[model samples]
Target: MTIPPGPYSPNPAPLLARALRALRRDTGLPVAFGGPVSRDGRGFVIEQLDGARTTSLLRLRVQAGAGLGGRALALARPWVVDDYFAAEEITHVYDHAVAPEHLRSIAAAPVVVDGAPRAVLYVASRSSVDFGDRLLESVARVVQLVERDLAVEEEGRRRLAAAPPALHSAEVHELVAELSQIAATVQDEGIRRRLVDVCRRTRLLAGRVPSADRSPAPAVAAVRLSPREREVLAEVARGCTNDEVAEALGLLPNTVKSYLKSAMRKLGATNRVQAVNLARAAGALD
Candidate 1:
Protein backbone atom coordinates (compact mmCIF):
# COMPACT_ATOMS: atom_id res chain seq x y z
CA MET A 1 0.00 0.00 0.00
CA THR A 2 2.00 2.94 -1.34
CA ILE A 3 1.03 6.50 -0.56
CA PRO A 4 1.56 9.62 -2.62
CA PRO A 5 4.45 11.97 -1.86
CA GLY A 6 3.54 14.16 1.10
CA PRO A 7 5.02 16.23 3.91
CA TYR A 8 5.01 13.21 6.21
CA SER A 9 7.94 10.90 5.52
CA PRO A 10 8.44 7.46 7.04
CA ASN A 11 11.27 7.30 9.57
CA PRO A 12 12.52 3.79 10.28
CA ALA A 13 15.14 4.84 12.79
CA PRO A 14 13.47 3.30 15.85
CA LEU A 15 12.71 0.03 14.06
CA LEU A 16 16.18 -0.10 12.56
CA ALA A 17 17.83 0.48 15.92
CA ARG A 18 15.71 -2.19 17.60
CA ALA A 19 16.37 -4.79 14.90
CA LEU A 20 20.10 -4.08 14.92
CA ARG A 21 20.21 -4.64 18.67
CA ALA A 22 18.34 -7.93 18.28
CA LEU A 23 20.66 -8.99 15.48
CA ARG A 24 23.75 -8.25 17.53
CA ARG A 25 22.36 -10.06 20.57
CA ASP A 26 21.24 -13.11 18.63
CA THR A 27 24.24 -13.38 16.28
CA GLY A 28 26.97 -12.01 18.61
CA LEU A 29 28.18 -9.72 15.87
CA PRO A 30 30.76 -7.11 16.86
CA VAL A 31 29.47 -4.29 14.71
CA ALA A 32 26.04 -3.55 13.25
CA PHE A 33 24.89 -0.38 11.51
CA GLY A 34 22.21 0.80 9.08
CA GLY A 35 19.64 3.51 8.31
CA PRO A 36 16.45 4.19 6.39
CA VAL A 37 16.61 5.12 2.72
CA SER A 38 16.33 8.81 1.92
CA ARG A 39 12.89 10.07 0.94
CA ASP A 40 14.11 10.62 -2.63
CA GLY A 41 15.20 6.93 -2.80
CA ARG A 42 18.71 7.86 -3.93
CA GLY A 43 20.63 6.61 -0.86
CA PHE A 44 20.69 6.09 2.92
CA VAL A 45 22.70 7.45 5.81
CA ILE A 46 24.12 5.26 8.56
CA GLU A 47 22.02 6.41 11.51
CA GLN A 48 22.45 3.33 13.73
CA LEU A 49 25.69 1.77 14.90
CA ASP A 50 26.01 -1.02 17.49
CA GLY A 51 29.22 -2.38 19.02
CA ALA A 52 31.21 0.04 16.92
CA ARG A 53 34.43 1.32 18.51
CA THR A 54 34.83 4.24 16.15
CA THR A 55 32.31 6.87 15.10
CA SER A 56 33.47 6.64 11.49
CA LEU A 57 30.54 4.49 10.36
CA LEU A 58 27.96 6.67 12.10
CA ARG A 59 26.18 9.26 9.95
CA LEU A 60 28.04 8.01 6.85
CA ARG A 61 26.01 8.26 3.66
CA VAL A 62 26.05 5.49 1.06
CA GLN A 63 24.80 5.88 -2.47
CA ALA A 64 23.07 3.24 -4.56
CA GLY A 65 25.42 0.96 -6.61
CA ALA A 66 28.46 2.38 -4.83
CA GLY A 67 29.41 0.05 -1.94
CA LEU A 68 28.47 -3.27 -0.39
CA GLY A 69 25.29 -1.84 1.11
CA GLY A 70 24.66 0.12 -2.07
CA ARG A 71 24.96 -3.10 -4.08
CA ALA A 72 22.46 -4.78 -1.75
CA LEU A 73 20.12 -1.86 -2.20
CA ALA A 74 20.48 -1.92 -5.98
CA LEU A 75 20.15 -5.70 -6.29
CA ALA A 76 17.46 -6.07 -3.60
CA ARG A 77 19.40 -8.94 -1.93
CA PRO A 78 22.00 -9.64 0.71
CA TRP A 79 25.74 -9.33 0.06
CA VAL A 80 28.80 -10.21 2.09
CA VAL A 81 32.46 -9.28 1.71
CA ASP A 82 35.12 -11.39 3.38
CA ASP A 83 37.69 -8.69 2.87
CA TYR A 84 36.17 -5.25 2.72
CA PHE A 85 39.14 -3.56 1.11
CA ALA A 86 39.71 -6.24 -1.51
CA ALA A 87 36.10 -6.79 -2.55
CA GLU A 88 36.12 -6.21 -6.31
CA GLU A 89 32.49 -7.15 -6.71
CA ILE A 90 31.34 -3.86 -5.13
CA THR A 91 32.40 -0.27 -5.75
CA HIS A 92 34.37 1.02 -2.76
CA VAL A 93 33.02 4.52 -2.21
CA TYR A 94 33.10 4.51 1.61
CA ASP A 95 36.58 3.11 2.07
CA HIS A 96 37.57 6.06 4.19
CA ALA A 97 34.81 5.35 6.68
CA VAL A 98 35.32 1.55 6.68
CA ALA A 99 39.07 1.82 7.19
CA PRO A 100 38.76 3.84 10.39
CA GLU A 101 36.13 1.47 11.74
CA HIS A 102 38.69 -1.40 11.37
CA LEU A 103 35.97 -3.55 9.87
CA ARG A 104 37.18 -6.29 7.52
CA SER A 105 34.20 -8.54 6.95
CA ILE A 106 30.87 -6.88 6.31
CA ALA A 107 27.40 -8.13 5.35
CA ALA A 108 24.59 -5.98 4.07
CA ALA A 109 20.92 -6.96 4.16
CA PRO A 110 18.42 -4.74 2.41
CA VAL A 111 15.01 -4.40 4.04
CA VAL A 112 12.50 -3.98 1.24
CA VAL A 113 8.86 -3.38 2.15
CA ASP A 114 6.02 -2.99 -0.33
CA GLY A 115 8.39 -3.10 -3.35
CA ALA A 116 10.54 -0.30 -1.91
CA PRO A 117 13.83 -0.42 -0.03
CA ARG A 118 13.04 0.97 3.43
CA ALA A 119 16.46 0.46 5.01
CA VAL A 120 19.75 -1.50 4.98
CA LEU A 121 21.28 -3.46 7.86
CA TYR A 122 24.97 -4.30 8.03
CA VAL A 123 26.90 -6.63 10.31
CA ALA A 124 30.63 -6.45 10.30
CA SER A 125 33.72 -7.93 11.96
CA ARG A 126 37.16 -6.51 12.72
CA SER A 127 39.01 -9.42 11.12
CA SER A 128 38.33 -10.92 7.74
CA VAL A 129 35.62 -13.54 8.23
CA ASP A 130 33.85 -15.67 5.68
CA PHE A 131 30.12 -15.29 6.22
CA GLY A 132 28.32 -18.60 5.76
CA ASP A 133 24.86 -19.23 4.37
CA ARG A 134 23.49 -19.79 7.87
CA LEU A 135 24.76 -16.45 9.13
CA LEU A 136 23.35 -14.73 6.06
CA GLU A 137 20.01 -16.42 6.67
CA SER A 138 19.94 -15.09 10.20
CA VAL A 139 20.50 -11.60 8.86
CA ALA A 140 17.76 -12.18 6.33
CA ARG A 141 15.35 -13.16 9.07
CA VAL A 142 16.02 -9.94 10.98
CA VAL A 143 15.56 -7.96 7.76
CA GLN A 144 12.21 -9.63 7.20
CA LEU A 145 11.05 -8.51 10.65
CA VAL A 146 12.03 -4.96 9.82
CA GLU A 147 10.20 -5.20 6.51
CA ARG A 148 7.04 -6.48 8.17
CA ASP A 149 7.10 -3.71 10.79
CA LEU A 150 7.63 -1.08 8.11
CA ALA A 151 4.73 -2.44 6.12
CA VAL A 152 2.44 -2.22 9.13
CA GLU A 153 3.58 1.30 9.92
CA GLU A 154 3.12 2.33 6.29
CA GLU A 155 -0.40 0.92 6.24
CA GLY A 156 -1.28 2.88 9.36
CA ARG A 157 0.00 6.05 7.73
CA ARG A 158 -1.95 5.33 4.56
CA ARG A 159 -5.17 4.85 6.49
CA LEU A 160 -4.54 8.03 8.45
CA ALA A 161 -4.10 9.94 5.20
CA ALA A 162 -7.32 8.49 3.86
CA ALA A 163 -9.22 9.43 7.01
CA PRO A 164 -11.11 12.69 7.00
CA PRO A 165 -9.55 15.59 8.87
CA ALA A 166 -12.64 15.90 11.06
CA LEU A 167 -12.73 12.47 12.68
CA HIS A 168 -15.60 13.48 15.00
CA SER A 169 -17.93 13.71 12.02
CA ALA A 170 -20.60 11.02 11.69
CA GLU A 171 -19.27 10.10 8.23
CA VAL A 172 -15.81 9.40 9.67
CA HIS A 173 -17.26 7.11 12.33
CA GLU A 174 -19.13 5.16 9.64
CA LEU A 175 -15.99 4.99 7.56
CA VAL A 176 -13.94 3.64 10.49
CA ALA A 177 -16.62 1.03 11.23
CA GLU A 178 -16.54 -0.15 7.62
CA LEU A 179 -12.75 -0.30 7.70
CA SER A 180 -12.86 -2.42 10.85
CA GLN A 181 -15.15 -4.90 9.06
CA ILE A 182 -12.82 -4.96 6.08
CA ALA A 183 -9.81 -5.56 8.32
CA ALA A 184 -11.42 -8.77 9.62
CA THR A 185 -11.63 -10.18 6.09
CA VAL A 186 -7.98 -9.55 5.20
CA GLN A 187 -5.77 -12.65 5.10
CA ASP A 188 -2.52 -10.89 6.00
CA GLU A 189 -2.41 -10.88 9.78
CA GLY A 190 0.08 -8.01 9.95
CA ILE A 191 -2.01 -5.79 7.67
CA ARG A 192 -5.23 -6.72 9.46
CA ARG A 193 -3.69 -5.87 12.82
CA ARG A 194 -2.55 -2.52 11.51
CA LEU A 195 -5.99 -1.72 10.08
CA VAL A 196 -7.55 -2.50 13.45
CA ASP A 197 -5.02 -0.22 15.11
CA VAL A 198 -5.91 2.49 12.63
CA CYS A 199 -9.57 2.19 13.59
CA ARG A 200 -8.70 2.53 17.27
CA ARG A 201 -6.60 5.60 16.56
CA THR A 202 -9.39 7.08 14.43
CA ARG A 203 -11.81 6.79 17.33
CA LEU A 204 -9.25 8.37 19.64
CA LEU A 205 -8.82 11.18 17.15
CA ALA A 206 -12.55 11.79 17.16
CA GLY A 207 -12.51 12.32 20.91
CA ARG A 208 -9.63 14.74 20.64
CA VAL A 209 -11.10 16.82 17.80
CA PRO A 210 -11.68 20.42 18.93
CA SER A 211 -15.09 22.05 18.69
CA ALA A 212 -16.31 25.44 19.96
CA ASP A 213 -19.89 24.23 19.95
CA ARG A 214 -19.14 21.15 22.07
CA SER A 215 -18.95 20.86 25.84
CA PRO A 216 -17.32 18.01 27.72
CA ALA A 217 -19.80 15.38 28.90
CA PRO A 218 -19.50 14.85 32.69
CA ALA A 219 -20.16 11.11 32.29
CA VAL A 220 -17.28 10.84 29.80
CA ALA A 221 -14.89 12.61 32.16
CA ALA A 222 -15.67 10.45 35.20
CA VAL A 223 -15.39 6.97 33.62
CA ARG A 224 -11.93 5.42 33.40
CA LEU A 225 -11.26 2.27 31.33
CA SER A 226 -8.09 0.28 31.70
CA PRO A 227 -5.86 0.00 28.64
CA ARG A 228 -7.01 -3.55 27.93
CA GLU A 229 -10.60 -2.62 28.58
CA ARG A 230 -10.30 0.29 26.17
CA GLU A 231 -8.83 -2.02 23.56
CA VAL A 232 -11.68 -4.55 23.89
CA LEU A 233 -14.29 -1.82 23.91
CA ALA A 234 -12.77 -0.20 20.83
CA GLU A 235 -13.23 -3.45 18.94
CA VAL A 236 -16.75 -3.80 20.30
CA ALA A 237 -17.48 -0.28 19.08
CA ARG A 238 -16.63 -1.62 15.62
CA GLY A 239 -19.49 -4.15 16.10
CA CYS A 240 -17.18 -7.14 16.48
CA THR A 241 -18.57 -10.25 18.22
CA ASN A 242 -16.84 -11.56 21.31
CA ASP A 243 -15.29 -14.35 19.24
CA GLU A 244 -14.10 -11.85 16.63
CA VAL A 245 -12.72 -9.55 19.32
CA ALA A 246 -10.87 -12.44 20.91
CA GLU A 247 -9.36 -13.40 17.56
CA ALA A 248 -8.35 -9.83 16.74
CA LEU A 249 -6.84 -9.21 20.15
CA GLY A 250 -5.29 -12.65 20.68
CA LEU A 251 -7.41 -13.12 23.81
CA LEU A 252 -9.75 -15.92 24.81
CA PRO A 253 -13.48 -15.55 24.21
CA ASN A 254 -14.16 -15.68 27.94
CA THR A 255 -11.65 -12.90 28.50
CA VAL A 256 -13.34 -10.78 25.85
CA LYS A 257 -16.72 -11.38 27.46
CA SER A 258 -15.37 -10.46 30.86
CA TYR A 259 -13.89 -7.20 29.57
CA LEU A 260 -17.15 -6.32 27.79
CA LYS A 261 -19.15 -7.00 30.92
CA SER A 262 -16.82 -4.95 33.09
CA ALA A 263 -16.92 -2.04 30.62
CA MET A 264 -20.72 -2.25 30.35
CA ARG A 265 -21.01 -2.15 34.13
CA LYS A 266 -18.83 0.99 34.34
CA LEU A 267 -20.83 2.71 31.60
CA GLY A 268 -24.22 1.58 32.94
CA ALA A 269 -25.00 -0.11 29.61
CA THR A 270 -27.24 -3.18 29.27
CA ASN A 271 -25.91 -4.27 25.85
CA ARG A 272 -22.84 -3.96 23.62
CA VAL A 273 -24.36 -1.16 21.51
CA GLN A 274 -25.31 0.89 24.52
CA ALA A 275 -21.90 0.34 26.07
CA VAL A 276 -20.14 1.57 22.93
CA ASN A 277 -22.44 4.56 22.65
CA LEU A 278 -21.92 5.46 26.30
CA ALA A 279 -18.16 4.99 25.95
CA ARG A 280 -18.16 7.26 22.93
CA ALA A 281 -20.23 9.88 24.69
CA ALA A 282 -17.95 9.61 27.72
CA GLY A 283 -14.82 10.00 25.55
CA ALA A 284 -13.61 6.53 26.62
CA LEU A 285 -13.76 5.32 23.03
CA ASP A 286 -12.88 8.71 21.60
Candidate 2:
Protein backbone atom coordinates (compact mmCIF):
# COMPACT_ATOMS: atom_id res chain seq x y z
CA MET A 1 0.00 0.00 0.00
CA THR A 2 3.06 2.20 0.47
CA ILE A 3 3.70 2.85 -3.23
CA PRO A 4 6.50 5.31 -2.57
CA PRO A 5 7.90 6.72 -5.76
CA GLY A 6 11.03 5.08 -7.18
CA PRO A 7 11.53 8.16 -9.35
CA TYR A 8 9.53 11.19 -10.26
CA SER A 9 7.17 11.04 -13.22
CA PRO A 10 4.10 13.03 -14.14
CA ASN A 11 0.72 11.69 -13.04
CA PRO A 12 -1.40 12.60 -15.98
CA ALA A 13 -5.12 12.94 -15.18
CA PRO A 14 -5.73 9.39 -13.96
CA LEU A 15 -9.46 9.82 -13.38
CA LEU A 16 -10.28 9.19 -17.02
CA ALA A 17 -8.17 6.05 -17.36
CA ARG A 18 -8.87 4.54 -13.93
CA ALA A 19 -12.62 5.09 -14.31
CA LEU A 20 -12.78 3.56 -17.79
CA ARG A 21 -10.77 0.47 -16.83
CA ALA A 22 -12.75 -0.08 -13.65
CA LEU A 23 -16.02 0.05 -15.59
CA ARG A 24 -14.63 -2.34 -18.18
CA ARG A 25 -14.37 -5.04 -15.47
CA ASP A 26 -18.06 -5.82 -15.80
CA THR A 27 -17.90 -8.18 -18.75
CA GLY A 28 -21.68 -8.13 -19.05
CA LEU A 29 -21.34 -4.78 -20.68
CA PRO A 30 -19.34 -5.09 -23.89
CA VAL A 31 -19.10 -1.32 -24.37
CA ALA A 32 -18.19 1.23 -21.73
CA PHE A 33 -16.90 4.79 -21.68
CA GLY A 34 -16.89 7.83 -19.44
CA GLY A 35 -15.38 11.26 -18.82
CA PRO A 36 -14.84 14.13 -16.42
CA VAL A 37 -17.34 16.89 -15.74
CA SER A 38 -16.06 20.20 -16.99
CA ARG A 39 -15.01 22.66 -14.35
CA ASP A 40 -17.66 25.05 -15.61
CA GLY A 41 -20.29 22.34 -14.86
CA ARG A 42 -22.03 23.04 -18.15
CA GLY A 43 -21.21 19.57 -19.45
CA PHE A 44 -18.75 16.67 -19.54
CA VAL A 45 -16.32 15.47 -22.21
CA ILE A 46 -15.57 11.80 -22.74
CA GLU A 47 -11.86 11.05 -22.55
CA GLN A 48 -11.73 7.27 -22.43
CA LEU A 49 -13.77 4.49 -24.05
CA ASP A 50 -13.46 0.72 -23.97
CA GLY A 51 -15.10 -1.59 -26.51
CA ALA A 52 -16.95 1.43 -27.70
CA ARG A 53 -19.30 0.85 -30.64
CA THR A 54 -18.90 4.30 -32.14
CA THR A 55 -16.32 7.03 -31.89
CA SER A 56 -19.29 9.41 -31.93
CA LEU A 57 -19.08 9.24 -28.13
CA LEU A 58 -15.54 10.59 -28.35
CA ARG A 59 -15.41 13.99 -26.77
CA LEU A 60 -19.18 13.92 -26.86
CA ARG A 61 -20.77 16.66 -24.86
CA VAL A 62 -23.44 15.78 -22.29
CA GLN A 63 -25.25 18.88 -21.23
CA ALA A 64 -26.50 19.10 -17.65
CA GLY A 65 -29.96 17.47 -17.16
CA ALA A 66 -29.98 16.11 -20.70
CA GLY A 67 -28.64 12.58 -21.28
CA LEU A 68 -28.08 9.66 -18.90
CA GLY A 69 -24.80 11.12 -17.71
CA GLY A 70 -26.23 14.58 -17.50
CA ARG A 71 -29.24 13.36 -15.55
CA ALA A 72 -27.00 11.54 -13.12
CA LEU A 73 -24.96 14.68 -12.64
CA ALA A 74 -28.06 16.75 -12.11
CA LEU A 75 -29.45 14.30 -9.56
CA ALA A 76 -26.06 13.66 -7.98
CA ARG A 77 -26.72 9.90 -7.96
CA PRO A 78 -26.70 6.81 -10.15
CA TRP A 79 -29.29 6.75 -12.95
CA VAL A 80 -30.05 3.88 -15.27
CA VAL A 81 -32.40 3.29 -18.17
CA ASP A 82 -33.58 -0.23 -18.89
CA ASP A 83 -34.08 0.95 -22.44
CA TYR A 84 -32.58 4.25 -23.49
CA PHE A 85 -35.27 4.83 -26.08
CA ALA A 86 -38.13 3.97 -23.67
CA ALA A 87 -36.93 4.83 -20.20
CA GLU A 88 -38.80 7.75 -18.63
CA GLU A 89 -36.46 8.34 -15.70
CA ILE A 90 -34.17 10.52 -17.86
CA THR A 91 -34.13 12.64 -21.04
CA HIS A 92 -33.21 11.30 -24.49
CA VAL A 93 -31.09 14.10 -25.88
CA TYR A 94 -28.39 11.80 -27.20
CA ASP A 95 -30.51 9.48 -29.34
CA HIS A 96 -28.73 10.33 -32.53
CA ALA A 97 -25.37 9.62 -30.92
CA VAL A 98 -26.69 6.55 -29.06
CA ALA A 99 -28.34 5.04 -32.16
CA PRO A 100 -25.11 5.00 -34.12
CA GLU A 101 -23.58 3.13 -31.23
CA HIS A 102 -26.67 0.83 -31.08
CA LEU A 103 -26.73 1.14 -27.29
CA ARG A 104 -29.99 -0.23 -25.86
CA SER A 105 -29.51 -0.23 -22.12
CA ILE A 106 -27.35 2.34 -20.33
CA ALA A 107 -26.45 3.42 -16.81
CA ALA A 108 -24.67 6.43 -15.40
CA ALA A 109 -23.30 7.68 -12.10
CA PRO A 110 -21.70 10.95 -11.18
CA VAL A 111 -18.09 10.92 -10.01
CA VAL A 112 -18.56 13.05 -6.94
CA VAL A 113 -15.59 14.64 -5.25
CA ASP A 114 -15.97 16.56 -1.97
CA GLY A 115 -19.80 16.63 -2.49
CA ALA A 116 -19.78 18.08 -6.01
CA PRO A 117 -20.07 16.20 -9.28
CA ARG A 118 -16.64 16.08 -10.89
CA ALA A 119 -17.41 13.59 -13.68
CA VAL A 120 -19.91 11.06 -15.01
CA LEU A 121 -19.33 7.38 -15.76
CA TYR A 122 -21.42 5.24 -18.11
CA VAL A 123 -21.78 1.62 -19.20
CA ALA A 124 -23.96 0.18 -21.93
CA SER A 125 -25.30 -3.09 -23.27
CA ARG A 126 -26.54 -3.63 -26.81
CA SER A 127 -29.27 -6.04 -25.69
CA SER A 128 -32.49 -5.23 -23.82
CA VAL A 129 -31.53 -6.43 -20.37
CA ASP A 130 -31.88 -3.93 -17.53
CA PHE A 131 -28.79 -3.10 -15.49
CA GLY A 132 -29.50 -4.23 -11.90
CA ASP A 133 -28.27 -3.26 -8.44
CA ARG A 134 -25.15 -5.45 -8.55
CA LEU A 135 -23.86 -3.76 -11.68
CA LEU A 136 -24.82 -0.37 -10.34
CA GLU A 137 -22.75 -1.01 -7.23
CA SER A 138 -19.72 -1.76 -9.41
CA VAL A 139 -20.04 1.61 -11.11
CA ALA A 140 -20.32 3.33 -7.74
CA ARG A 141 -17.15 1.62 -6.50
CA VAL A 142 -15.23 2.79 -9.55
CA VAL A 143 -16.49 6.34 -9.19
CA GLN A 144 -15.51 6.38 -5.53
CA LEU A 145 -12.02 5.12 -6.33
CA VAL A 146 -11.51 7.73 -9.05
CA GLU A 147 -12.80 10.43 -6.73
CA ARG A 148 -10.16 9.52 -4.19
CA ASP A 149 -7.49 9.76 -6.87
CA LEU A 150 -8.65 13.22 -7.95
CA ALA A 151 -8.87 14.54 -4.40
CA VAL A 152 -5.24 13.58 -3.83
CA GLU A 153 -4.19 15.08 -7.17
CA GLU A 154 -6.02 18.30 -6.46
CA GLU A 155 -4.03 18.62 -3.24
CA GLY A 156 -0.79 18.14 -5.15
CA ARG A 157 -1.67 20.87 -7.64
CA ARG A 158 -2.61 23.25 -4.85
CA ARG A 159 0.68 22.62 -3.08
CA LEU A 160 2.74 23.06 -6.26
CA ALA A 161 0.87 26.24 -7.09
CA ALA A 162 1.56 27.63 -3.64
CA ALA A 163 5.21 26.52 -3.37
CA PRO A 164 8.03 29.06 -2.96
CA PRO A 165 10.09 29.95 -6.05
CA ALA A 166 13.32 28.26 -4.94
CA LEU A 167 11.43 25.13 -3.90
CA HIS A 168 9.67 24.92 -7.25
CA SER A 169 12.72 23.19 -8.71
CA ALA A 170 11.90 20.03 -6.75
CA GLU A 171 9.57 17.77 -8.72
CA VAL A 172 5.89 17.60 -7.70
CA HIS A 173 5.19 14.92 -10.29
CA GLU A 174 6.93 12.10 -8.41
CA LEU A 175 5.32 12.95 -5.11
CA VAL A 176 1.92 13.07 -6.75
CA ALA A 177 2.61 9.83 -8.57
CA GLU A 178 3.46 8.15 -5.28
CA LEU A 179 0.22 9.38 -3.71
CA SER A 180 -1.76 8.29 -6.76
CA GLN A 181 -0.36 4.76 -6.55
CA ILE A 182 -1.22 4.35 -2.88
CA ALA A 183 -4.66 5.91 -3.26
CA ALA A 184 -5.51 3.62 -6.15
CA THR A 185 -5.32 0.57 -3.88
CA VAL A 186 -7.18 1.95 -0.86
CA GLN A 187 -10.71 0.53 -0.65
CA ASP A 188 -12.26 3.22 1.47
CA GLU A 189 -12.84 6.39 -0.51
CA GLY A 190 -12.78 8.71 2.49
CA ILE A 191 -9.65 7.16 3.94
CA ARG A 192 -7.95 7.05 0.53
CA ARG A 193 -8.70 10.69 -0.23
CA ARG A 194 -7.48 11.84 3.16
CA LEU A 195 -4.32 9.76 2.90
CA VAL A 196 -3.60 11.25 -0.52
CA ASP A 197 -3.95 14.78 0.83
CA VAL A 198 -1.50 14.08 3.66
CA CYS A 199 0.94 12.41 1.27
CA ARG A 200 0.90 15.34 -1.14
CA ARG A 201 1.40 18.04 1.49
CA THR A 202 3.92 16.00 3.46
CA ARG A 203 6.02 15.12 0.42
CA LEU A 204 5.88 18.69 -0.88
CA LEU A 205 7.25 20.10 2.36
CA ALA A 206 9.90 17.39 2.56
CA GLY A 207 10.96 17.89 -1.03
CA ARG A 208 10.93 21.69 -0.96
CA VAL A 209 12.24 22.51 2.54
CA PRO A 210 15.12 19.97 2.39
CA SER A 211 15.71 17.14 4.94
CA ALA A 212 18.53 15.02 6.44
CA ASP A 213 19.19 12.40 3.76
CA ARG A 214 15.97 13.58 2.05
CA SER A 215 12.87 11.42 2.37
CA PRO A 216 12.52 11.29 -1.38
CA ALA A 217 16.05 10.10 -1.80
CA PRO A 218 17.29 10.08 -5.39
CA ALA A 219 19.71 7.45 -6.64
CA VAL A 220 23.23 8.12 -7.91
CA ALA A 221 25.60 5.43 -9.23
CA ALA A 222 24.96 2.26 -7.15
CA VAL A 223 25.62 3.73 -3.71
CA ARG A 224 21.99 3.78 -2.63
CA LEU A 225 20.73 5.21 0.68
CA SER A 226 17.53 3.97 2.28
CA PRO A 227 14.68 6.48 2.17
CA ARG A 228 15.24 7.06 5.90
CA GLU A 229 18.96 7.57 5.35
CA ARG A 230 18.27 9.98 2.50
CA GLU A 231 15.82 11.86 4.70
CA VAL A 232 18.29 11.98 7.56
CA LEU A 233 21.04 13.28 5.27
CA ALA A 234 18.70 15.89 3.76
CA GLU A 235 18.02 17.30 7.25
CA VAL A 236 21.74 17.37 7.96
CA ALA A 237 22.28 19.24 4.72
CA ARG A 238 19.62 21.70 5.94
CA GLY A 239 21.89 22.17 9.03
CA CYS A 240 19.59 20.36 11.49
CA THR A 241 21.37 18.62 14.34
CA ASN A 242 20.47 15.07 15.48
CA ASP A 243 17.64 16.17 17.82
CA GLU A 244 16.15 18.57 15.27
CA VAL A 245 16.47 16.01 12.49
CA ALA A 246 14.83 13.37 14.70
CA GLU A 247 11.86 15.64 15.49
CA ALA A 248 11.49 16.66 11.84
CA LEU A 249 11.81 13.14 10.46
CA GLY A 250 9.55 11.77 13.27
CA LEU A 251 12.34 9.55 14.61
CA LEU A 252 14.11 9.42 17.97
CA PRO A 253 17.46 11.20 18.31
CA ASN A 254 19.41 7.94 18.34
CA THR A 255 17.47 6.65 15.31
CA VAL A 256 18.26 9.83 13.44
CA LYS A 257 21.93 9.39 14.30
CA SER A 258 21.79 5.76 13.16
CA TYR A 259 20.33 6.61 9.71
CA LEU A 260 22.85 9.43 9.30
CA LYS A 261 25.62 7.03 10.20
CA SER A 262 24.32 4.46 7.71
CA ALA A 263 24.05 7.07 4.95
CA MET A 264 27.53 8.39 5.73
CA ARG A 265 28.98 4.90 5.49
CA LYS A 266 27.26 4.26 2.13
CA LEU A 267 28.50 7.61 0.77
CA GLY A 268 32.09 6.69 1.86
CA ALA A 269 32.08 9.53 4.39
CA THR A 270 33.48 9.25 7.90
CA ASN A 271 31.01 11.74 9.42
CA ARG A 272 27.58 13.38 9.04
CA VAL A 273 28.85 16.66 7.51
CA GLN A 274 31.08 14.79 5.07
CA ALA A 275 28.18 12.53 3.99
CA VAL A 276 25.97 15.55 3.22
CA ASN A 277 28.77 17.22 1.26
CA LEU A 278 29.41 14.06 -0.74
CA ALA A 279 25.71 13.61 -1.50
CA ARG A 280 25.43 17.18 -2.76
CA ALA A 281 28.54 16.77 -4.91
CA ALA A 282 27.02 13.60 -6.42
CA GLY A 283 23.69 15.36 -7.25
CA ALA A 284 21.79 13.16 -4.82
CA LEU A 285 20.33 16.22 -3.09
CA ASP A 286 19.91 19.86 -4.05
Q: TM-score of each candidate?
A: 0.67, 0.59
Q: State the lDDT at 79 in candidate 1.
A: 89
C-alpha positional error of residue 278 in candidate 1 after TM-score superposition, expressed in Å: 7.4
Per-residue lDDT of candidate 1, residues 1-286 (tens digit):
2123342344566667878887887667788999888766678888889998889888888898889999998898888999999989999879999888889999998888878787889998898776887777778788887777666556656766877576554544555655565554544444566566666667666566777523444365588888888999888755577998999999999999999899888888777765775677667776
* lDDT of model 1 at position 163: 73
Candidate 1 differs from the real structure by a C-alpha RMSD in angstroms, to one decimal, of 7.0
Mind sharing the TM-score for model 2? 0.59
Scored by Cα lDDT, where does model 2 land? 0.67
**lDDT of all the models against the reference?**
0.76, 0.67
* Candidate number of the best TM-score: 1
Residue 234 CA error for candidate 2 (Å)? 17
RMSD of 2: 11.4
On residues 249-281, what C-alpha lDDT tens digit does candidate 2 reach at each position? 789998987788778778887666557645654
